[model samples]
Target: MARPGPRPARDHGRRSQPRPAPRPRGRRRRAPHVRERAVPALAHEGEVPSLARRRLSRLSRGVPARLRGPRLLRRALSRDDRRPCARPEAQARLRGRGEGSRLRGAEADEVGLVLGSTQDRHRGGLVSGIRLERTGALVTARFDKARGNAIDEPFTQELLQVAKELGADPGVRGVLLASAHPKLFSPGLDLVTLIEYDRAAMERFMRLFAQAVWALYALPKPVVAAINGHAVAGGCILALTADYRILRRGGVQVGLNEVKVGVPLPWSVALLLRASVPPTALTSVALLGRNFADDEAIAVGLADQLADADGFEDFGRARLEEFADKDTDSIAITKGYLRDAVLREMRARESEEMDAWLERWFSDGTRERIRQIVAGMGKGR
Candidate 1:
C-alpha cells in the first residue's frame, strides 16, 4: 500500500497539457484586402476605372498627402510588362506620336498582297520596292532578275509604278530601301538609259528620278536604308531619302561623288541631304564630293545608325518591328507634315541655283582632285 501511494504522487501537477491540434496545412490565413485582390478579374472585370481608383486608395491609405501625387503617377504609368510582343497590326502601328536605290541585273519578285483587291499582288516595281521577310517585318528593296530588277528604262517604269502604288496604299507600314547587289546598292542611274536617250528623254529621266527620290522622302511610314555595299551618287541619294541609314561595316564608301562622274546631285536629292545630313557634313560632302567611311558618315548625320556587316538583317528587322509597334496614323500624319516642309524647300530652289551651288563647290576642279585621290589609292572604280 505504501508503494502504490508513492507512485500516485508522481508529478501530475508538473505535466504539461497536450498541445492543441495543429491548423490544417492548406488553410492559409490572409489579410482581408489581400483576399479581395486575389480574385482580381472577378471583382473588377467591367469596372476598370473604379478598380484602379480602389487599388490606388488601398495603396495610399497610410501615406502622407504630399507623397501621394508622385506615388500615384508612378503607379499609373508603370507597366508591369515592358517587353515587346508581336502586337496586332493596328496596335503595332501606334508606338510613336511624332516623329533605295536601284541595282544592276533583273529585278526580284518581292510583292505582297493587298487586301480585297482583285489583283492581290502589290503594285509592280516602284510600289513593290519593299520586300517583306518571313522572320521579321524586313522590307528590302529588290534587284532580282525575274521581276526586272535591272536598272534600265523598263525597270524604272516598273519601279515608278510600284512607288505610285505604295503612295496610294493606306496600309503600307514602312520602307527599307535595300539592294540585291552584293557590292553596290546602285551604280548611280542606269547610264545605259541616260546615255542612250535624247534631250527630251533625259529631261524625263531627271524628272522621274527626282520624283522617285521625293516619293521615298515623302513615305509616311518610317524608311530605313541598309546599304550592304557601296552607295554612290544616285544610290547615295536613295540612302539619303530614308529617315534612318544603317551602313554595313567595312568595304563600303558612301557619299554624293557625282562630281567625279560629271554630274551634280539632283535638286530634290540635294534638298534631302540638306534636311537629313548635318550642315557641316553636308557642306563637306556635297561641296567636296568626298567619300565618307562608315564612322564618318555617322558623324556627319548621313547614317543615323551603324552596325556590323554581318548583322544588318537582324538589326534592320528589329528596327522595323519597333516601327510597327508605333501608331501608324500618327506616324503617317507627322511624316506628311514634315515632308510638306521639305517639298516646299525643294520647290523654292531653282535649277540654276542648284547648279550654281554645285559648280561653285564640286565642279570639274573637285572631280579631278577626286580622280587623283582614287588613282593614288589604287581604286580603279
Candidate 2:
C-alpha cells in the first residue's frame, strides 16, 4: 500500500541539464520611410556638376543603406543646404551641415581626417573621406568593389575633395591615392552622361569639377598617387594630379584615353596633366590612348615611383613624408604661385567653351566610336 501510494516517484530533482533556450526567429527589419525629406542639397559652395547631381541621384538609389559605403555617405550627408551661388541663408545652412555628418558612420574608419569646411577655420570636406594610416604616414584605400570604381563624376569629385582637404589642412603633410578596387583606378567617365545629358549641363559640370581640381593642385602638401591597379581615362587624369605617381610593378595599365573615346580632352583636364607631366612625354598616353604598364608609365614620366602592390603604400608614404617634412610655408606659397596662372586661365575660360567641348565630344561621331569600343571590349558601356 505504501509503495502504491508513493508510485515510484520520478526523479524530478535529477534536474536534467536545463533545456537550451529556444533560438530567436529574427524579424525582418522594416526600412524607415523618408522622414525628413530634405531635397538633396549641395554640401559645399563650389559648383556641383549637373552630371554629378544626376549620377548621385542614381547612385543614391540602388545602394543598400548598410552598403552605402562610408565615404559616399559622408559626402552625401555632409552637403551644405545651400546650392552653390545661393542666397546667404542657404550658405549659412550649408556651413552648419558641413563635414560633421560624414564623420558619423562605420565608413569613417577609412577616413584620415576632415580637412575642408564651410568656415575658413576648419574647411573639412576637402579631406573628409578615408585616410588609411600605417604608422604616422597616410595611405589611400584600394578598390573593394566589382564593376570597378567607375570614373564617373562622383568618383572624380571624391578625388577632388580629398585633394582640396590636403590643400586646406596645414597639418596633413602627405597623402597616397591607393585603390581598394581591383584592377582599379577607374574604368572611365559615364558614357550615359556623355551621351544623354544636354550640353549646358556638361559644361556646368566641367566648371565645377575644374575648380575643384584647381583647388587640389594648389595644395601645399605633397600628394602621392599609389596606383594599386589599372588607371583608365579619367582615372589616369586623377592619378596624374598627384605630385608623385607610384604604380604596382606588374598590376597597372594607365593613360588618358580621350582619343579612344574620339573626344578631345577638356581644356582644363589637359592643362592639369600638362602641369604634372611634360607635354612631349604625355603624347602617347593622352593621344594614342594606349594603356602603358607600370614600367612604361614610369618611363614616360606618368609615374614617379614603382613598387609591388604589397609595398606600394609603405613606399609612397615614405615619399610623401619626405616632402611633408619640408618647410611647408614655402611649399604652400610656391604651390599657390605656380597655380595662379592656371587658375586665371580657368577663370577666364567661358562656360560656353566647356559646353561646346562636351557637345562635340558627345556628338554622334564620338558616341558611335565609344559604343564600338565598349562593345568590342565586351564590358557594359
Candidate 3:
C-alpha cells in the first residue's frame, strides 16, 4: 500500500475517440499476402544453423506451398537489403515458381545465383546441406553444411527433393554429388542429436534416408561422387549410391562403420553396398566397419577412380562428361539393369530390415554407446 502497488498499470482504451482511418491514396495497397511467407522470408538472412533448422521444420509442415508466389516473393525481393539480393532473372525464377518445382526453405536467393548464373555469385553464399549448380549438361550438388555437413533430417530431405527435380529435368544430363569441404565430405549422421531418438523417430529418419539414397541410386542418369574428404558411416553409403566414385587419394577417411557404433546397416544401405562393393570384399567392408584408405577403398570397389588433391573436381567432371556424351537413354537403361535389382531387393526386405535395425538402435547397450559418443562430440566441436 505504501509503494502504491507499482503505480497501477495505465489502461489504454482501444479507441478513446473516433480515430481517422488510414488515408487511401490513389492506389490501394494489396495488404500483405507476404505475411504467410513472413516466417520463411525472415529466415533468409544469414541465420544461425539452429535458427535455420527451426525454419526448415516450419517448411516441412507445407510452408513452401505458401511460397509467397510471384507477388510475395517479388515484393519481398524488391526491398534492397544492401546485401546481394535476388537479381531480376533470379526473381523471375522464384516468381514463376519454376526453379525446379519447389525451392527448399529460404534458399530463394541461393537457388537463383547457383543455377548456373555465374561462378562468382555461387561462391558468395553457402547454403545449408546441399548446393546445386548446373555447369553445361552436368548438375553438381555440393554437400556443404555447418559442423562438418552432418546427415540430419534437412540433409536427407533436401537431397531427396533435389534428386526428384534433377530426375525430372531433361536438361540435366549427368549429376555429380560431392562435398564442398576441402577435407571432410561429411561426418555422417548427427548421432549426437540422434542418440535421443526413440524407435519412431529413428524409423522416420531411416525411412527418409532410404528414399534419398534410392532417389540418387535410381536417378536414371549418370551420378558420380567426388570423395574429396572423410566419408564415414552414413557418408560411405551415400558415396556407394553413385554410379562411379572418384576418391582423392590423400588425407581422406572413407567407409561404413555402422556396426562399430552398434547400429546395423538397414536394407537400403545393404543394397547400395552390395551393388557398389565387390562381393569378395563385402565382409571386410561392411562387417569390420573400419575406415578404408585410398588404395584399399579402390581395391574394395568403394571408389572407382583416384584423383589428386587439386584435380578432384576435374576428375568428377571428366567422368560425368564421358557419360553425358554417350546415348543417355542407353546409359540409363544399362544403369537400370545393374541397380534395378538392388532397388527391388531393398524394397522387398525394407520392413524386416527396419524392424531389426530399430531393435538394435534402441537396445540398452547401444544407448550407452551412443550417449558416450555424443558426450565426446560436444568436447571436440
Give the best candidate by lDDT.
3
lDDT for each of the candidates? 0.56, 0.59, 0.71
The candidate, 2 or 3, that scores higher on TM-score is 3
Candidate 1, residues 1-381, lDDT tens digits: the string is 455453333355775556699878753443335324433322212122222344456666665544555335324211211111122342334345222111111111122211111111243212222222212233444443222232555445545555565556565666666765677766566553344455556565666666666667777777777777778776777788777788888857888876666566677777788888778687788888988777888898777777786768558756776786789889888888878998877767745554454443344575565556546545543
* Candidate 2 per-residue C-alpha lDDT over 1-381 given as tens digits, one digit per residue, 9 for 90 to 100: 455553343467664565699967664333332212232333332333333344445556765554444344334443322322222233344465656333322223233322222211144332222323322334343332234655444445655665565456554566666765656766666564444556666665676667656665666667788787778887777676677888889857888878867777877777777776677776786678778886778777778877876766678777887887788778778877877787677667745467667766768998788777656656544
- TM-score, structure 1 vs. true: 0.57
Sort order, TM-score high to low: 3, 2, 1
Top-down lDDT ranking? 3, 2, 1
**lDDT winner between candidates 1 and 2:** 2
Q: Which regions of candidate 1 fall more than 4 Å away from where they truly are?
A: 1-138, 145-152, 348-381
